[model samples]
Target: MLIRQLEYLVALGREQHFGRAAAVCYVSQPALSAAIRKLENELDVTIVLRGRRFEGFTDEGRRVVGWAHRILAERDALLADLDRMRNGLRATVRIGAIPTAVPATPLMSSLFSTRYPLARVRIESLSSREISRRLAEFELDAGVTYLDNDTPPGTRSVELYRERYRLLVPADDELARESVVEWAAAAALPHCALMSTMRNRRVLDANMAAAGATLVPVVETDTVGALYAHIATRRLASIVAHTWLHAFGVPEGMCVRPLAEVRPRPAVGLIVSDREPTSIVVDALVDALSGADLSEALERSLPPVIPG
Candidate 1:
């Protein structure tokens, strides 16, 4: 019924715990529960399944939650439109980015901020699948993720760059002497890499397979920082996106080399919902990035690999 009720419902659906949902909505548990009960009474449908705790949403509740997502998104868009009419753009643009794409978000955000100084940008490091899911659910305004593979449906994108792979090794390592490293050779080293669940790791696996190699990482982690830590300590080498080097530079005691085999690199870009009456913040972000030659800019900024 009320917008606040819908907000509480959406938060409950996302958190799946009464206390957590109440905390997110900035209300007491009893207040949030009363709002949901009032909503259910008005709709004449059982929205949530109940037990000692938050069990799950009913089938009808699932549909309601889906509609709630759109409604809240539209409400935000309306506010953004009015703000833009009176002042400059002044809305928070929530973005979910795959870890490999995380490094490149600043390139997009910096451009967005320069144009719309009042607008806020929030970035989250998420898996590719999560980015796709959140965008479809209106939880994310846009995403920075691989555009060439498993792109979310009903969305359009502006390709920023094609991501290339590189091998990272300690300066004292044997492979560090080479100007370029083959995938098979990189695979043979004691490797630390992203977890197999990540799309980036899957991409690396496919490339290595094409090169007659297989990745058997000595350690697997979800974060790039952990991978870098292993390589920096000379405990392991890693195959990582060139964007990582461009963003963070080579870790101390480590050097990067180009991969010898040139496979078709995946395009990483900004993706937003393609439906009519899109979010104004999303539109502003796309406009900010559409004309910029980010690929060239990132290439120019890529840190030089230290000599062996």
Candidate 2:
């Protein structure tokens, strides 16, 4: 039926309640419900669950919602194509990135903003698995994350930089005087580590295992701020990506040294959906980043950590 009905259906699926869905669609609940009824009548199938309160969708309704997502996404892409043909590219590009890439998002946002001044951009920090899942669901335009043998299908990747490891040790620590440290030495220290819940941590685990080393962190945190806080103690150290140092200066009393023994470094890159008919906005953003000054974005020199 009407595209508006499909829009309502998709919104309903997203918000999972009639009132909130109507609010998102900028319509009253009654009107939105009537539109859904009409859509079901036209399609000759029951698409919405009939209930006094918000209930889960029926199996068929779920399938319709999936189709609705694809339809609305393609429709928006078509509109973006037309708008770019007549005018310049002007549409919101929502990007999702892993926590490790959060510091790098502004580079992409600024580039997009400069190229298409009128276009809107949003970058959200997410887990790598979440990024890949959202990309497949058409919820994200692109993502920045580690790419390895396990990279998900239906993605077009552009390598940005290799993620190198650095050991952040207190200035007075035994290993602080060294310009470089072996993984075995770093693994033995009482350190703060990113929680294993993250794919980044998993990658680190695999790399350390390969080096015959293991991390037995004194503190584990999900956020960088927390991890940094734990590292404030001269008794603790952390092995982190050098890329992260560009965002947060090294903690107080900490000195960074490259890891001399992690044989291969994992690459971090930008990944977009490989849909057959790619979105115009995705293409434009990729083109903008094609000649990106990655060196600046990849800056990893450790700053002198002042005592806090």
Candidate 3:
């Protein structure tokens, strides 16, 4: 089917309303509806359920919508490739990064923009699973997420930096007397750990279990802000990624110390699909990431894994 037809069909699937989808495509409602009908006839499938209002797509229509997404994505990539060939290296770069990695994004973006002044960057915060999915779907040009895990086929990863976990406790706690609180020691204290939903929390739970301590958190939250706010009130202690400590400044009377003997420092890396040819914008980002000293940056701004 024609690319424009696929576009109209995809918009209908997303909008779920003929008038609304037509508005999105900047076409008259009847014109958009006629294009979708043409597409359905060409494919020999009933793509949409007809009614006074747009009801929904049939199972066949849903499958077609999935294909339509990939087709549109590939079309955009092709156009982007052609533009890059005609003009210099300048285009929008879509990126997905894990929550803990957000702090480094601005630094990396600034470095890239300074080097390549003409390009634009769009960043979205997402979980590791979502990042991988988006990368495979060609929705994201690249992603920053935990490495060493099994990556999707036809994608390659490059190590950007190592992310270490730390114990964040109020300064007045008994463990705060020490410069570095061992994992065994910190685990014994009442923890204000992240809820079980976050990967960081899972990593912490595994490490704490090995240290002969079970996390008995007084409070649990998904966001760093919630954890920090609880810690600031002296109501909870938390295990957090060292980078998070950098983004959300450590509270007063808080200590950050590395947890010893945690498996896989959880290297955060940039992942790009091998199937889609890398654009100049992506290449520049890769180059900047490879050369940058992210560890040093983390140390300068981020608090020590434990209170100093």
Best prediction by lDDT: 1
After aligning candidate 3 to the native by TM-score, how far in Å is the CA of 83 from where it should be?
Answer: 3.7
Runs with alpha carbons beyond 4 Å of true place in candidate 2:
50-52, 232-235, 291-297, 300-308
Each model's lDDT = 0.88, 0.81, 0.76
Answer with 1 or 3, whichever has the higher lDDT: 1
lDDT of 3 by residue, 111-205 (tens): 67877677789999888788887776557889987776555567777776787776676767776667656777887787777678777677777
Model 1, residue 290: displacement in angstroms? 1.0
Q: Model 1: residues >4 Å from true position, as ranges?
A: 305-308
* Candidate 1 collision pairs: none
For candidate 1, the C-alpha RMSD (Å) to the true structure equals: 1.6
Estimate, for each residue in 1-308, the C-alpha lDDT of model 1 and write its tens digit. Answer: 89999999999989999999999889999999999999999999999999999999999999999899999999989988998999989899999988878888888899999999999999999887888889878999999988874897889999999888888787788899888888888899889999998888999999888889899999999998888777777557888887788777887777788788565778888899998887899989999999788888888987776567
Question: How well does candidate 2 match the true structure in TM-score terms?
Answer: 0.88
Reference-based TM-score, model 1: 0.94
**Per-candidate clash tally:** 0, 0, 9
The full ranking of all candidates by lDDT, starting with the best, is 1, 2, 3
Error of 1 at 248 (Å): 1.6
Candidate 2 accuracy as lDDT:
0.81
